[model samples]
Target: MALREQLDADMKTALREKDSLKLSTVRMIKSAMKYKETEPGAAGPLDDAGILQVITSEIKKRRDSVTEYEKAGRSDLADKEKAEIAVLQHYLPEQLTAAELEKAVADAIAEAGAEGPRDMGKVMKVLTPRIQGRADGKVAADLVKQKLAT
Candidate 1:
């Protein structure tokens, strides 16, 4: 089934099971997705990749919140953000391990012929799609810089 259908089904399940956190998270995702579908230029219902894009963006926002909450000494809010992250993460592709990410970055650098930090753009262009939603952009960029500078 398409992600939209899956979300609908999950929403029902969350309701039936009284899973408030999951229900809210799913509802938030569905809301974003519905907005996307009805947006002026949308062609049709979202494909899996499109749905994943929305989920990934949501997760990124939650991660930022987690960081901010932690910095502000609000463990309660940070914990909630972490819980939301856990729920949202189920929709993402498996994350790359440190070794896997390092290897992939090296390959991207080589493929893009990136010889130095100045070539970061070229390497990122080649790398971003390959690792999308699988690796954090900041981590990937840091790894790329480390690899390129050596």
Candidate 2:
């Protein structure tokens, strides 16, 4: 099934199961998707890839919140954000393993013929699409930087 359909089904299941956390997170995702759909130049309803982008963005936001909450010594709020992250993560593609990400970064570097750090953009241009929704951009960029530094 498509992601939209899956979300609908899961939403219904959450409602039935009285899973407040999941229901709220799913609603949040749908809200974000609706907002994206209405954005200027939005092509229309999102495809799976587009929906994945939205889901990924939501997860990132939660992660940032978790960090901020932790810094404020609000363990309760941080735990909430972490739970939301867990809910949001279910919809994303399985994350790339460290070795897999390293290999992919190396492959991108070679494919782009990136000779040094100056060519980071070139490597990332080749890499981003391949890793999108499966790997964190910061992690991938850091790996690229590490590989390029040597």
Candidate 3:
């Protein structure tokens, strides 16, 4: 089923099961998807990749907020953001392990013939699609840097 439909079904199930966290998280995702649908030039309904991108962006935003809140000594706010992140992550694909990410970066570097950091753009071009929805861009970039430096 389409992600949006699946999310809607899950939302209903969550309501019936009294899963407050999942319900809220799913509703937030649904709202973001709806907003994207209404945006200009969005084309038809978003594909799985597009939905994953939206979910990833939402998680990234929450993570960033958690960092900022913690830096400001607002532990309560940070905790709330972290909780939301945990809930949202339940829908994401299993993340790549460090070792697996290293392998992926090495492969991408080899495929792109990236000899040095100057070829980061080329490496990123080859790596982004491979890692998309499976890992964070920052994490992937770090792995790519580590692979290229050696």
TM-score of each: 0.91, 0.98, 0.91
Task: Name the lDDT value of residue 143 in candidate 3.
Answer: 76
Tens digits of per-residue lDDT, candidate 2, 1-150, equal: 999999999999999999999999999999999999999999999999999999999988999999999999999999999999998889988999999999999999999999999999999999999999999999999999999999
lDDT of 3 by residue, 35-100 (tens): 888899888688888889989999999999998999999999999889889887777789999888
Which ten-residue region of model 2 has the weakest summed lDDT? 85-94
Residues 24-119, candidate 1, lDDT per residue (tens digit)?
999999889889999998988888888988898898899999999999999999999999999999888899999999989989998999889999
Off by over 4 Å in 3: none
lDDT against true structure, model 2 = 0.95
Candidate 1 achieves a global lDDT of 0.91
Ordering by lDDT: 2, 1, 3
Distance from true position, residue 36, model 2, in Å?
0.8
lDDT of each: 0.91, 0.95, 0.88
How many times do residue backbones clash in model 2? 0
TM-score-based ranking, best first? 2, 3, 1
The candidate scoring highest on lDDT is 2
* Cα lDDT for residue 64, candidate 1: 91
Q: In angstroms, how far off is 142's CA in candidate 3?
A: 1.2
